[model samples]
Target: METNMTLYHGSNIDFEKISLDKAKDKRDFGRGFYTTTIREQAKEWAEILNYRSRRDGCFLYEFTFEKTDNLHIKSFNGITEEWLNFIVENRLKGGVQHSFDVVIGPVANDRTVNTIGLYLSGDYFLDEALRRLEYFKLNDQVSLHTEKALSYLKFIRKYTWTA
Candidate 1:
């Protein structure tokens, strides 16, 4: 129940605007502008993306947003059957699956991606997936899913991780 917090977004390129249209589908939280509460995690993402495309160099954008009762939000504090199913539906369906303006939850990072994949592929059952997921630490992600949600975020600054 954090009301206000700083968030970071790591990207291959720097952009002045945050555009949901450019966001890739089938994401953990569905097509939306994603940020994280962890700075190190965001930096790691920038490094990985930088290694992949080397675009405009690794960039970490900082933003701050305050939670309000006026906006619809979905939050997952930990891995659960509901969280697992939500991710599965979003990944398999390739679009927004809910009406929430923002979603805050545990990210299915590198450690959990394989487990999630196995579950999706039917190689692992729900109970097995949950059991496997417990072995890895999860990161938090804050995704803005609407223009109204996006407006709440105020850009703080941008850090260039690569020269």
Candidate 2:
């Protein structure tokens, strides 16, 4: 499939009321604006977040990567020792500091959440965690990790949730 620069961020709140400043810490790839190439995954995220916020449906916000220049970027092609470590680091309570302005890779979804939790809690080592994650096909995501990267994300449009 042809990848578009356009990406989407889903939330339970309405578009107008959405605020980037309100984002909390201890998130995947740190507290930053996260978008994905897969719309279905965004929908799934919306539905999941909506359940907790008591929002009616998901709000899809579109954005574009404006600066694809010599910007600092990192891409993990697939599940690997390094990829699993990166995800584990970012999701940990203290959080990991990364040099990349943007990081692109698979998401740690519901299926892998517990395994990640196990790894974080010292229940599973790297190899064991990765072995478990390999069972489920992961989805791709792009996360803008710095203000410099976030500045390049230009909002394109908003779509209502009906799916």
Candidate 3:
């Protein structure tokens, strides 16, 4: 099942860059068009995550271990819930949706296990959403990818004005 969450931002922006002149051209049929806006956003998010990772120095990794160790004991757990709430509250506003699946497994040493998951979310503005999600994998560093997707969704949310 696909889960949807909306991130609310307070303004509108032009996210669709395809020109009618170009779109109407018969030769353009089946030809793929590209947009760099989301790419830029993803880059921004990646940088943020990278910086945090560098500073935390395996904090994310350790958190994963802790969560796995106490999986059965549920009650306002560790960074997982904190991360989820952070993403949901801050990143996921203005009609932007984020969906992700949790994964747990063993790391280098057989004695210890690692727990991590991919957070999948994107905007409705472009066709690249599903492509991006499909390309992502567990343990893959995709802060930028997710960020760009979210940015695009924010772009879409802005134009879908109801007021």
Q: Which number leads on TM-score?
A: 1
The CA lDDT at 60 in model 2 is 80
Which stretches of model 2 miss by more than 4 angstroms?
1-4, 16-20
- Give the better candidate number (1 or 3) by lDDT: 1
Model 1, span 21-83: residue lDDT tens: 999899998989999999988988888988888565889999989888879999998999999
TM-scores, each model vs. reference: 0.94, 0.84, 0.18
Per-prediction tally of clashes: 0, 0, 10
lDDT of 2: 0.76
Model 1, poorest ten-residue lDDT window?
Answer: 47-56
- What's the lDDT of the predicted structure labeled candidate 1? 0.90
| Best-fitting candidate, scored by lDDT | 1
List model 2 lDDT by residue over 52-150, tens digit each. Answer: 877677788877766476568888988888888777677774343688888888888878889988988899998898889898988888887677777
Per-residue CA lDDT of candidate 3, range 1-163, in tens?
2223222211122234323233211110111111222333333333454465453211111001112222221122222333333333423242212232122111111111111112333333123422332333322111111222323222232222111
Candidate 3, residue 62: the lDDT equals 7
Show model 1 residue runs off by greater than 4 Å: none
